[model samples]
Target: MGINLQKGQKISLDKEAGGGLSHIVMGVGWDAATGKTGMLGGLFGGGGGNIDLDASCLMFDEQGNQTDAVWFRQLRSRDGSIQHTGDNLTGEGEGDDEQIKVDLSAVPANVKSLVFTVNNYTGQDFSKVANAFCRIVNGANDSEIARYDLSCQGSHNAMVMAKLYRHNNEWKMHAIGETGKGRTFEELLPQIKPHL
Candidate 1:
C-alpha cells in the first residue's frame, strides 16, 4: 500500500520509488455526490448528475513562470515529456477518471515544477462531487506511491490538487488541497503562483 497523504504533506518520489523512478502516473478520480438534501440539492435537481471534471498539469520554471501545460485541449506537453490521457466527461468510473503521465527523466531541466489541478468543467461546485482523489503510481510496476483524498466540500468549482517539484536534484510530491473557483487551469493560475 502507498502512503495516504494528507493536505500539505510531502514525499520524496525518488525515495518512494527506490531510485529508478523514471516515469510516474498521476491519476485523479471522483464521483457525483448523490442525494444531497438542501438548497444545493434543489439547485442540482436532487443531486445525481454527471460532473465533468478536467485534470490538468501546468509546468513551471525555477522562477515560477509557466513553461508548458497539458490538459484536455492540449493532450501533450510541448516537449512531449508529459501527456494527459484524456478527459472524463461524466465522472462515472470505478478507477481514475483522468490520468496524466510524466516522464521524469525526459522533462527538461529548465522545468522545475509540475502542478496538477482539477476543475469542474460543468461549473458545478465541489459540494456536488464526492470521493475525489489524486494518486501517484509507479509507471514501472504500477504500484501506488501515494494518494491524497480531496475531501473538502464547498462552493468552489476547482482545486489545486498536488505538485511534483524538484528539490536537491530529486523529484518530490506535495499534496496541496487548496480550493478556488475556476472552470479551467488558466483561471487557477493566479491562485497557484503563491504555492509555487
Candidate 2:
C-alpha cells in the first residue's frame, strides 16, 4: 500500500520506487454526485447527460514554460514520452475515469515537470461530482504509489490536481488540489504556472 496524501503534501517518487522508477500512470477517478435521481440526467441543467472529465498533462522545462501537452485531443506528447488514455465521457465504473501514462526515463532532459490535471469538458462543475481522486501507480508492476482524494465539491470546472517534478535529479509528486474554471488545459495554463 502507498501513502494517502493530502492537499499540499509532497512525496519523493525516487525514494518510493527505490530510485529505479522509470514509468508511471497518473489515474483520475470520480463518479457523478447526483441527488436522488440515481442517475446523472439533467442534474446540472446542462443537459440530460453524463459528465465528461478529461485527464491531461502539461510538460514544462526548467524555466517553467510549457513545452508540450497531452490531452484528449492530442493523445501523445511530441517526444512520445507521455500519452493520455483518452477522454472519459461518463464518470462511471469502479476504477479510473482517465489515465495518463508517462515514461520518466524517456522524457527529455530539458523537461523538468509534468502537471497532471482534470477538467470538466462538459461545462459541468465539480459540485455535481463525487469520489474524485488522483493516484499514481507503478506502470511496471501495477502497484500504487500514492493517492490524493479531491474531496472538495464546488462550482469549479477544473482542477490542477497534482504534479511530478524534478528535484536533485529525482522526481517528486506534489498534491496541488487547486480548483479552477476551465473547459480545457489551455485555459488552465494561468492557474498551473504558479505551481510549476
Best by TM-score: 1
Output the lDDT of residue 19, model 2. 68
TM-score of 1: 0.94
The clash number for model 1 is 0
- Cα lDDT tens digits, model 2, 67-115, are 9999999999999999889888998899888999999999999999999
Summing lDDT over every window of 10 consecutive residues in candidate 2, give the lowest-scoring window: 36-45
**TM-scores for candidates 1 onward, in order:** 0.94, 0.93
> How badly does each model clash, as a count of residue pairs?
0, 1
Residue 64 CA error for candidate 1 (Å)? Answer: 0.9
lDDT of 1 by residue, 1-196 (tens): 7899999999999888788899999999999887776777678676556899999999999999999999999999999999999999998869899999999999999999999999999898999899999999999999999999995889999999999999998999999989999899999999999989
* Alpha carbon lDDT of each predicted model: 0.92, 0.88
Please name the candidate that would achieve the greatest lDDT relative to the true structure. Answer: 1
Q: Assess candidate 1 and give its lDDT.
A: 0.92
Residue 24 displacement in candidate 1 (angstroms)? 0.4
Question: Which stretches of candidate 2 lie above 4 Å from their native place?
Answer: 36-48
